[model samples]
Structure formats: C-alpha cells, structure tokens
Target chain A: MELGLVHYLILVAILFCIGILGLIISRNIVKILISIEILLNAVNINFAAFANFGDLDEAKGQVFAIFIMAIAAAEIALGLAILIACYNNRHSIDIEDYTSLKS
Target chain B: MEVLQFLFFGMFALVIVISALGAIFCRNIIHSIVSLVITFLSVSGIFILLNADFLAISQIIIYAVGITILLVFSLMFTTTKDDNKLWLAFAPRTILAFVVAGTLFILLMFNITNKFTDFNINPKSFITKAPKESTIELLKKQGTTPIIGKQLLTKYVLPFEILSILLLGVIIGAAVIAKKDTNEKNRASESA
Candidate 1:
C-alpha cells in the first residue's frame, strides 16, 4: 500500500509517544536528554511531512529544523556542563539524588 | 507500485522504535547514547523521505555526529564503569508517568481521528509529481540557497548574531563550571 500523509502522521505520532515514554521512564540524566532529542525529532518529522504534502513550502520546515538543531546543540552543551558539575559535587549521576535541591 | 515508499517508511519506523526502546531500556548510559545516535540517523532518513534533503543532512551532521559525541565524552568523565548502576530505582513516579503518557496518547488519537475523518486519502497528486521539477527546479529557479543566505544575513541577521553570542556564552559557562579549583584539596589527592 502507498504511504500517504496520514501514514506519515501516524508514524510521527507513534515515534513521539515512544520518545515521551523514554523521557518518563529513563532515570539516567543522559538518557533523559536523548529522549528529549527523540521528541524534538518527532516534531521535525511532522514539520517536514507537512511541508512536503500539505504545502509546497519546503524551505520553511527545513529552516525551522535547522534552528531546532542549533537550539538542541546549545541545550546539550549547557545541560552536559551542568550534569558534569553535579557529578563533580555529588559523584553520582542519578536523578533521585538530585532531590536534595528540591524545595 | 508504491511498495518502495512503504518499505522505506516501515524501515524508518522500525529503526526509530528500536533505537528509542534501546535508549529507554538500556542499563548502560553509553549504550543509550549510541542508540540515540541511531535514532537521530533514522529521523534524518525520514526527513529525506519527506523531501527535505537539507534538513536531513543537517540532522545527521548536527545531531548524530556533534551532539551524541559530546554526550558520550561527558558520560565518560562523569561516571566510571565500577560506579555505574545497572538499573535505576523505580517508585511511585513511574506510575504517575504511565498515567500521564497514556492519557495524552488517548487525547492525541481522538483529535487525529476527528480531524482526519473527512479528508481525502489520495496520494497520487503528491506522489506522482516528479521531485526534480517540484523541489530542486523550483529552488534553482528562485536561486534558493542564495535567497536563504541573504535572509540569514539581512532580515534574520539579529537572531543569527544572537545565536553566535549565545554559543560563545555557553562555551564560557561550561569552562567555568567544569574547571577544577586548585585552591581546594583535590579529591583524588586526598583519597590517595
């Protein structure tokens, strides 16, 4: 069967759900960051698919995806630095251990 | 006739799902990072399938190559194999997560069903159109890359400049955070 726009949307939805599951279930801080990447990719898929089929404006989605990648790179750098600092202080990367800072 | 597209979609979906599962279920953080790289590649493939070649290349280069390597290097310094735990502890938070995710999925499916019910499912108009004329030709006709380059320099120049500054700030912030203070007694020396 030919894959249509709906099929792509469904695929994106499923991938997004999996990404969300990863975000919720993974306890390792690094894994959580990776899950966030997955979620961002799911959004990218939707944007590109819409640009391809629903509209002819491919540049819009491509440009947006480029911006998303830049933001993601910045986010990863900042997050990893913070994580490293946390590890330096506590010697543990567990999210559970971060509760001491919780108010 | 369209079996190739279906196969591509199926392969992309499989890679995305398996890599995501690997990222979630793996006990080794490094392994999860590798799986995330795979997931990023698969997503890039999907972008190509959607006819966004530029985004696909950027996704692979930026995400798989740059970010994943940065994460893995950070992981190396942060935790040793001996100190790493096999699995994370589960608690009431897991239950809450399941409930929230399930509810959101149901709501999403409901919305999709309602919205797409009346839409025509035909794929011919979109599929049969040759890619050369539709995208590449149009882009060439419009001097696409140059247009984008000009916009990046002119209209969106502020955001472009701000992004460079933000990246510089992140570099400085990271250096400050990761630098060890020599004034204090180092942990390794104290332990030795």
Candidate 2:
C-alpha cells in the first residue's frame, strides 16, 4: 500500500485518542503527564507531515513543532516540580489524593 | 523504492502505536517511561520519513533523551516501593474515559477520511498539497536545519524569544517549588 497523508493523519488520530484515554483514566500523576506528552507528540507528527507534504518551502509547520517542543519541555519541568511538591506534602503519587481544591 | 518507503512507514507507525499503549498501560512507572522512550524514538523515525531531518534529530535529543531523563528523575523523587501498583484507576469514570476517547476518534476519522471512504480509495485527495520539486530538492540536499533556523529567527522570532523567557521561568519555578522550605525545617527543630 502506498503511504499517503491520510495514513499519517490516521496514525496521529489513534495516538491522540490513546493520549486522551490515558489522561482521563490514569490515577498516577506521572502517567497523566506522560499522556500530555503523548498528545503533544501526536501534534508534532501532524505538523511535520504537513510541512513535508503541504508546504515544504517554508516549513512553517516544522517551526511550530519546534516551538511546541520547547513548550513541552517547560511544561514537564514545571509539572514534575509540582508533582514533587505535592508528593512531599502528602507522601503519595495518586491524583485522587490531591483533591483539596475540589470544595 | 516506493514499497521500501511504505514498509518503513508501517514499521514506524506500528512501533509508535504499540509503545504508546505500553507507556500508558504498563504497571510499573519505570516500564511506562521506558515505553515512552520507545514511542518517542519511533516518532523521530516518522519525522525522518517525512523528511524533517532536523526535527528528527531534535526529537531524539529533546524527547527521547531529555524528557525521558526528567520523567525518570521525577519518578524517583516522588515514588515509594508501593507506587508500582498505582497504575490505572478502576473507577466508573474509566468507562467514561473510554467512551469519550472512542467518540473523539470516530469523529476525527470520519472527518479526515471523508466518512471513511477516502482513506483507502482516494487518499491522495486529502489535505496534503503537492510539494514543490525544487524545494524538495533543496531540502534533500541541504537538510532542514538551516531552514528551521532561518524561520525561527525571521518569521518566528518573537515566539522564539518568548520561548526562551518561558524556559527561564520554568527553571526558576521548578527549583523554587521543589526546594525544601528552610522555615518549616527551623520551626520543627525549635519545637522538637
């Protein structure tokens, strides 16, 4: 079968759905963060694929992907830091334990 | 050559999907993180296939190595031995999650594939534009790094600077948030 743009899009859609599933169902804070990473990766694939196929001259999609990578790095750094802070306070990594703001 | 390219794409896509599933479902956090690394590497392979050579390298550096290390370090800092069992929640909301994700996937697939008919029969009529041959030739010869750098400095300079600022803020914020409070320690010692 010839690989087409639809193939990449379908693959990314599957990855994105899996990411959403993980984000919703996982109880571990770390796993939630990993789900976010997966979602971002799916976006990156979409951008790169478009850059390759749609606009190879400017490659603006790839530029946006780079921007996304930078933001993802910053996000995970801060997310882990917050996770560590919460772990220190409660001595637990479960998301259900950190529901103090739910009131 | 065309068949070879298709085979490579299939391999990378398969690896990406399988590893991504493993990353979420693996019981041990370490195993999940390892699976995440595999997924990232496979994604980089896809980038290479898409001819984003520079992004492929950056994916290896940023996601595969840097992010994996940060995740492992966070896991080490936060987990006890018992945390291994803290994988999935068996709550009723788990079913809700599956439903929502399934619906979203169906919606996206329906739209992208033109109600699932275009996927196999008319894949070429999708959102993709025909790439200019000269640009492809230039990309093949010089690679994408210089193009990316030029774009970042010219068209995306403002966002580029903002990203640097964001990184600085993240570094400081993480350090502050994770640091032990000296005041709490002193008070506990005095009360003891």
DockQ, per model, reads 0.54, 0.79
Cα lDDT tens digits for candidate 1, B1-192:
589988998998898888888887788777778888889889888877776767787888899999988988898888777534735448676776677677777666566555435334433334423344556677646533454466577767888788889889988988888776665557667878
TM-score attained by model 2: 0.96
TM-score of every prediction relative to native: 0.85, 0.96
Q: Quality of candidate 1's docking, in CAPRI categories?
A: medium
Q: Which structure among the candidates has the greatest lDDT? A: 2
Please give the distance, in angstroms, between residue A26's alpha carbon in candidate 2 and its true position after superposition. Answer: 0.8
What is the per-residue lDDT of model 2 for residues A54-94, given as tens digits with 9 covering 90 to 100? 88888999999999999999999999999988888999999
**Alpha-carbon runs more than 4 Å astray in model 2:** B120-127
Error of 2 at B153 (Å): 0.9
The list of candidate 1 runs beyond 4 A from truth reads B82-86, B115-136, B139-151, B185-192
